[model samples]
Target: MRSISVKIVIKTFLLVLVFGIFSKIYGQTDLAVKQKSNFWKQVQFGGGFGLNIGTGFTDVTLAPNAIYNLNQYLALGAGLQGSIVSQKDYYSSAIYGVNTIVLINPVEEVQLSIELEQVRVNNTFRNPTTGIVKDNFWNTGLFVGGGYRMENVTMGMRYNLLFNKDKNVYADAMMPFIRVYF
Candidate 1:
């Protein structure tokens, strides 16, 4: 009975000591965070428009976005992106999902990023005179891209290989984007 009581007392002391140490650590962390909060509010809103000219086609696209800093090291934003795609035998419309951006700055005015977004495409392939509709379709693809920032603007490109095996037999696409970030 005495041994049991002594063991309980020792355990209680150790637990109290551990809690005290953790509390001190947490207090220091809180102080550091409060000191750095101002630097994070320097976020701004910006985006860009670019023309895509590729193999046998041309597209006009616009993407507008905003960024909010979560901390001194990370920022997040979303935007609208769309394009009018033209082909030799078809006309298609494409839209971008809420393009989510994660900004990680390694140096002043320079950032590396990982982005997740969806691309949507709708097209019509039919003879104008024959009145026979050959194809009408829509699709969505997931993609990842990265960018480099210079001053108040950024430039980047990404690739998306769609996997709509049923309607999109040969519907794989790759896009390069350039944007100005304020």
Candidate 2:
């Protein structure tokens, strides 16, 4: 009962946001040119990185991306993703991937996104009695989400449309993120 109502509220909130943003976008009355005249002026580059090292575990991530703003409302971009993670005497993995993204900013403070990603995962697990086991596979995901935006940064949550419990690296299909692009 409560959970169902929460979901409905969330959906309604998103609809309201989209409607407000669209109205603001089309309501512009300024005579100013809406797009940049120089191609180079529309390009931006940025990425995300993470490093975590503790007692017996280590995880490092690097993802670099570039986007070309088609105009005030649209952007198309691509990025590379890489990660090295290890747990002592347990497992170690190398992940590499590429992704393409489309971002739409109907209003300066709200952005919607769709991204397609393919990652190759190589993992090795150690067992005292079984020697070692190696697992390698490719995982692809299509993510659709939105975020609150401020300048070149956005904070949001995205859900993977093709998540499998046994075949996924993440524990859940939903992931929270803070994205920054210059």
Candidate 3:
């Protein structure tokens, strides 16, 4: 699982790099002619939705955000996120988080983004040995990541760089995301 995740990340980064280079070469003239807009006109609304289902596992996530275009090249935004996950006779969990994001667009269609997030997770586990179920304590995580962006949407991956394996509710080293803008 880890190897596959790493491979995907590498491929994504490479694709972004190639796209950036090509855009720079062909889109330089387009950058000089910047379109002017008002503050409200520069604001955008969007978010992400995800669902995963398997034989005995299910997860759903929804994140909504608002973005302000600072200029032709920079943008800032904030958002809220909520998620739920469950596994048959195993565990069920709920996650909530707040995030702030910064995006840089070197060209019209290509973007780079950095995001910081604080998340709280609550979990309930079923102990097979004791045939009992108990609720675990709440835990918080701080995550950061950078990724490639596109017009009206972004496809990227993130990781909890500050997580402690023993205590952190999030175990995945890399998580992919798809966000849309309206």
User: Evaluated with lDDT, which candidate comes out highest?
Assistant: 2
Q: Model 3 off-target regions past 4 Å?
A: 1-37, 131-146
Task: Estimate candidate 1's alpha-carbon lDDT, on a 0 to 1 scale.
Answer: 0.67
Candidate closest to the true structure, highest TM-score: 2
What lDDT tens digits, residue by residue, belong to model 3 across residues 33-119? 443335668989998888999999999999999999889899899999999999999888888888888878888766667777777
Model 3: residue 151 alpha-carbon error in angstroms: 1.8
1-182: candidate 2 lDDT, tens digit per residue: 99999999999999999999987777663213344346668989988899999999999999999999999999999999999999999999999999999999999999999989999999999999998999999999889889999999999988899999899877888898888987
Residue 120 of model 2 has an lDDT of 97
In order of appearance, the predictions have TM-scores of: 0.54, 0.78, 0.66
Off by over 4 Å in 2: 1-37
User: How would you encode candidate 1's per-residue C-alpha lDDT over 114-161 as one tens digit per residue?
Assistant: 665555556655467875444544545555555676676667655555
Show pairs that collide, candidate 3. none
What TM-score would you give candidate 2 relative to the actual structure?
0.78
181 Cα displacement, candidate 1 (Å): 1.5
RMSD in angstroms between candidate 3 and the native structure over all alpha carbons: 23.3
Clash pairs, candidate 1, are none
By lDDT: ranked, best first:
2, 3, 1
